[model samples]
Target: MTNFLPMTKDDMSKRGWDQLDFLFVSGDAYVDHPSFGPAIICRLLEKSGYKVGIIAQPDWRSTNDFKRLGKPKLGILVSAGNLDSMLNKYTAAKKYRSTDNYSPGGQAGLRPERATIVYCNRIREIWKHTPLIIGGIEGSLRRFAHYDYWSDSVRRSILVDSRADLLIYGMGEKQIKEVAAQLSAGISIENIRDIAGTCYRTETLEHLWDYIEIPSYQDVVNSKKDFANAFKFQYLEQDPIRGKTLAQGHGEQFVVQNQPAMPLTTPEMDEIYDLPYQRTYHPSYTAAGGIPAIQEVKFSIVSHRGCYGSCSFCALYAHQGRIIQARSTESILREAQEIVKMPDFKGYIHDVGGPTANFRQPACEHQMDRGTCRGKQCLFPNACKSLDTSHTEYLQLLREIRKIPGVKKVFVRSGLRYDYLMAANDMEFLRELCEHHVSGQLKVAPEHISPKVTKLMGKAGKETYLKFKKAYEKVNKDLGKEQYLVPYFMSSHPGSGLKEAIEMAEFLRDTGYNPEQVQDFIPTPGSLSTCMYYTGINPLTEEKVYVAKTPHDKRLQRALLQYRNPKNYELVREALVKAGRQDLIGYEAKCLIRPPRNKQNIAVSQPENWNKKRRLAPSRTQHSKTKQTRKI
Candidate 1:
């Protein structure tokens, strides 16, 4: 009972099982913790009285590694790990990353690029008749014809490319369990298309009713405008209550996505989190340094799931949906107590929330009966009147966790929606957060300071962040604490041009804070921002937006965010001059960077064989006034 599900045939024989009910293939090293998606799915299947085997990070070059557990009697469940495999391998700049935190020993390149497609193709080679189900972030996001940032082209749905029988979008706990039961009950995978939160390929749409038909696959590839339109249609129908079935043509067959599954109730969420998770990597990985991703969440507790923040660049809406489902208070406190007993528990809880930390309930009561509003967000532009912004329950939960014996400090490492916090009528929660929860510095993602860019990103106005900043400072001052705020900003987001980046640089200069790292926008699939980035038009508004496409322009925009750094000074200067704001290059108090050191500095800063004219009159020389001080 203390052992993990069989990973090898010898272990399988010891379990006295002839054939598994399911074989779960994953792109990440197996860490039997609730935070790992494959772990949660496999445990759910196991608890449902199924013999589930795991094949983690298999060699994709051939089918040998995939056949280790043999084929399951019911089906094959495939996932591209917890993260999108492309994102795992490449940075926003499309450069190969050196380490993969989800792998054993934090090794890179253990999982192949596009792991889901590779795994499914291999399974097809050995077991052609078994049901193939693809899920997780990579498959879910690419369940539709999506723009592949790594390839710079629109690709067909993963269902088509992987040739899997089904793709479970969003969190697949409910969907996967239902599929398993139906399959066990002697239903064919192709016949199990009526379930919610699932996609399947079919040759005919005669049986479907009241579904929205998006543009065909070839149409999206032929026109970026059509792709934008298709995305908008998909975006409006993500809700479980009011969403309709979506059908898109792929050659002779069609990919149909049913309406999203209803969000898990509080008790359902509690039950899932309460399952017997080993809460760590298996003992087999002890020699390989264990999975590095577990270290971040080992002491943390996920109090909830789903986010209503709905930032344009985030895929939470597509993957987790907008409905918030949280574990009960009693359930969370129980987990905290369990953490306190851990041998590695050093009197601190790393994090206490998920997605958005302060969100303990839905945006409003109606979202339970009706789904999240279409074409509108709960907290973007302005907080909706129906938005139930309260902190009483969450504040009480935090207080209770802090009082747990042996738990010295309960920190909230997850990002908190500052605008939501500001919506609360009372400042007591904010006061408590500053005094106890903040660990010297609290990180908040303001993303950008310009109103234009923030609006395009579906974030609150710049004024909201400024207001929260003042309130945070006031609370810290009253508590006699020197806590600081670390605001995260992005560069080269759609609708942000040189002028906007320059304005952001000025904002940073005035605030007197220098950020060491800046995020350049990467157009990940399934986000509204990616739509805008690909089509040059906001999918929601149908208005053209400026996108920094060239490497030179993107580098300039990123440099503006960290203009204080010595290396970025030249890039910042070049950007300022290009934007015709040369005033920002001088030695003035508000200037972002000083004039280049000397003529030699200019030569070194300019690009190779550069012949552009010297922009700001040569670096002004500093003159000693000792001899000229006679004038009163």
Candidate 2:
């Protein structure tokens, strides 16, 4: 059948099944699109001859709403939606957000806080002995007893907190299939702990063989050095091929995480995307303005998975691993053909890329067998010697996508790895990208121009960004195009102080671009940057770093990015003065802002008695005359 899987009891009856084999509960509203992780996992289960039903965003106030789908015959699958629930609900300041893109109608607060723990606990309350499996960004990233930025302390593993029988970390396709097969064969959840990409709590160490034991939960919480050492080891062992089983003790019990699952091959990636997907939100949500997250990716194509960039603030390494697994060109073209047939299809295909648009293959040949280097990065600290810098295949694929009928333009909306592109030195791809892909503006993240800050953020030096900017301008000039590079910068990241923020502001002043929006570093879980923010030490190097923790400093740093805005005039001047740059506050061309509108200067420029007498109330005629006089 081409319809969505059973979502309610009536739909289950129509399927002629007494009970579903698996019940998937998600924090997001039901959307059967491929980009949503719940939809992908549920559909993959159905394709394997298992009956799966979805209960999305169920009322978590009690177990009554969870019983709507009834108990499953085999197990319950729970995901805290696509993005991490904490990240979706709170800003860096730990303030509640006003809009949730994953909810119906983009509503906020549709799901509870710490959604995975809430959903899993609710299932346990009713089902008693049923297998509760937790997988998603929230669960995967917090699988270990790492830091919790929201809680502001080191919490135990989610496997301990959620009371889940099994925790599937990372991309869970391979792990999900394995769990389904074992559960179908009547295996106990406790006995199924040996599978890769899974975590479970155990009382004894007998089940774990040849594993590395991370620091005990109590020790990590008490000692920053111990936590940094533990994280460094965990980061190194993330490679699927060379990774070892990792175990961490939580008082009397232990949370054991197995080696990461292997990366999918090209054919496997193609098969995963070729599966039947409704490719849109369930029609039941039409009245609630439909699911807001689907609009961005409904017409887009995901050509690959995983990223090699490994930025410090990003969690892709811990979740998707470092290797790149891509779908075939034929599969991409097939998806494009399907998009052309949609009734609402416009001539534009929004994006034809993945995590990083330009990264289409592994960094080197050794990565597949030996795994990513333990202590080294692929693109940072200069590209590795064995890195593959070819864009020939990706260039050809984009060209083919453009040739498809009904496709007027194909844009690469994902952030391009500028350092990677610079490594390629391929003018043809750059030429095609400048002429065809860019829509008057291309957004690239250089983060900050300060060498001290960029190094701490795991980004290339300012020299690399400058080289790319020059090259981009040359290409546009040659093509007779007016496209511009809108660079992304962050404020208040570790290693960024008032001095570094002012340095970035000077770079912005020179470049003639004012950022409309700025990102303040929010210390989310499973990131190196968050570790530094919490412990004041870089985990990789064990060096004490500067972190802007006060709200006053953070606001001052953010205001420097948009120093031209008159609303931020006082804040910008304050930052400049505080950073020992008081010389930059005068009427010089290089000054960030005029010296706070001096009253003496205003008196000289204004009419004789402009502020001599302040009027609290005025007649309509007087108000009109005052407004006209001020304008003159």
Candidate 3:
């Protein structure tokens, strides 16, 4: 009897409908929260006077479950949940993940490896000629020819691979609306090629205009350089304002991607967030452990979308765009009131931020008009002179959220960029953060302490991190608070070698900080770092970058990052000797590890020609020919 979207045929019958307008198939469980893409898209379609139902995590092995709601009136919308299906199922080490947060009861293997392709294939067995549209982080990021970390090879665009009629690439509120309207107006899915933020396959490029053609899938598979160059073109043309149509060839056909959808205005953002949502997992899931992913966002409110802090390893900018679109304070406050009204409401409002918490507005005025600078970064190589450094509005919004009637402790757990905060040149926000927001420790991502690696990561150098550390200590000192800074670090990135990893270990030694959590870099699709990982060349620079592809090579770097762990002792020693830094193996006070005693001495499994292998590793080189890649 509840107003949840029809997940069952009976629910459709309850709504007095024989067939629905859209039957959305998602890789994740049915969670009616706005943070979930499937929820927003379905709710938006419903708002447009279309009946929408969701078939979450359908048994892809057969067509029976997919037929539960029969075929949709317009088309079947598909998504591999909020996360890519491959990423959701695998870990950085290419091992089975222990659990899937998006699944009911936090189960794994409920969804297939490539859910969109698998689901569509199964549905095709039943509804052979029905329109199939795919979109989500997985579909969007892999909308072009991409390197699949799991498969360890170049794969065709999802639009081509899944044989979907269309692919929505970015945040889909706008694109979905346009697509649904066009479909309702009796436009063939094949003819709906002009919508922004969408991709489609064509037999020829005759219908396309204002487009740049990248190398074909065959071209990339044959040459690494061509792969890097193709990614560069896809990266540069992602902006809605300045971006142009891009087409990549697949066999005899071409997959064309239209310009990105424009960033949603504040009122537009408010409208999407203000939509009626049940704000939790479907009732049937309650008997199980419920959807694990909802717990993170059920109480947390997303204040904005998109991030300008373009760390190379992050895919946010690729999916969300660099231009920030934030909800009005009143809109956010209304969501907070709704949170307070929940039956299980606690005094604590967990987190209030987006991809980057401190970035509530666009970096500068130019982004809204001209789009973000193509080949330049906003915060890397020092914050741009035109960057907006003030945090007044964000700070004020936080103040207002905490003062809400039932809220007791409001936290900002979505980590803020320390570099962005430092660029402000004002301590007011920092002081306020230390005094109020932090829960004894504030986690920041300096990522690495080595200059070479950090530079390649598009991150601030060690100097900036040190300056921020000193200032943070002073702020906490002035406030008489014992708050600490927990910095996040990544190992085995594109530019990192044993030498850079050692530099990080030494920094940890000097700081006397031992991190319990270490993030080893994972090369997922649609990220600059992933491109570098696949090609061993920086797409933005066309420069040869050192990449550790071997499992042993990666282990060495990860071991060096967590050098203090006793389990890493042998691996750390192996890495140090391989790097020709055997002096670090001594019992000196500055040494990474004390020399092993006779009883403790153990041999680590390493290549017979360790020195030769280390010497053979790729090193950085200058190649400026392909300099037109995406920086953010």
Per-residue CA lDDT of model 1 for 1-632, tens digit only, reads 34787888888899898889999999998898889999999999999999999999999998899989877899999999988999999988889999988988999989999999999999999999899999999999998999998999999999999999999998899998999999999999989989999999999999998999999899999998899999999999889999999999999999999999989989889888888888999777789898998988999999999999999999889898889999999999999998899898899998999889998899999998877898899987888999998889999999999988999999987979999988875599998998889887777889898888999998887788889999999999999987777778899999999999988888876676666667888888799999999999998889999999888899999999877668887788888888888887654566676566776655325443222321322211111111110000
Clashes of each: 0, 0, 0
Looking at candidate 2, the ten consecutive residues that score lowest on lDDT are: 623-632
Model 1 local distance difference test score: 0.88
**TM-scores across all candidates?**
0.94, 0.94, 0.94
Better of 1 and 2 by lDDT: 1
The all-Cα superposition gives candidate 1 an RMSD in Å to the true structure of: 7.8
Show the lowest summed lDDT stretch of 10 residues, model 1: 623-632
Report the lDDT of model 1 for residue 440: 77
lDDT, candidate 2, 298-368, per-residue tens: 88999999998988988889998899999999999999999999999988898888889999988899999
TM-score of structure candidate 3: 0.94
RMSD of each: 7.8, 7.1, 7.4
Candidate 3, residues 50-105: lDDT per residue as tens digits?
A: 99999999988888999999888899999999888988888789999989889989
Candidate 2 residue 424 C-alpha distance from true site, Å: 0.8
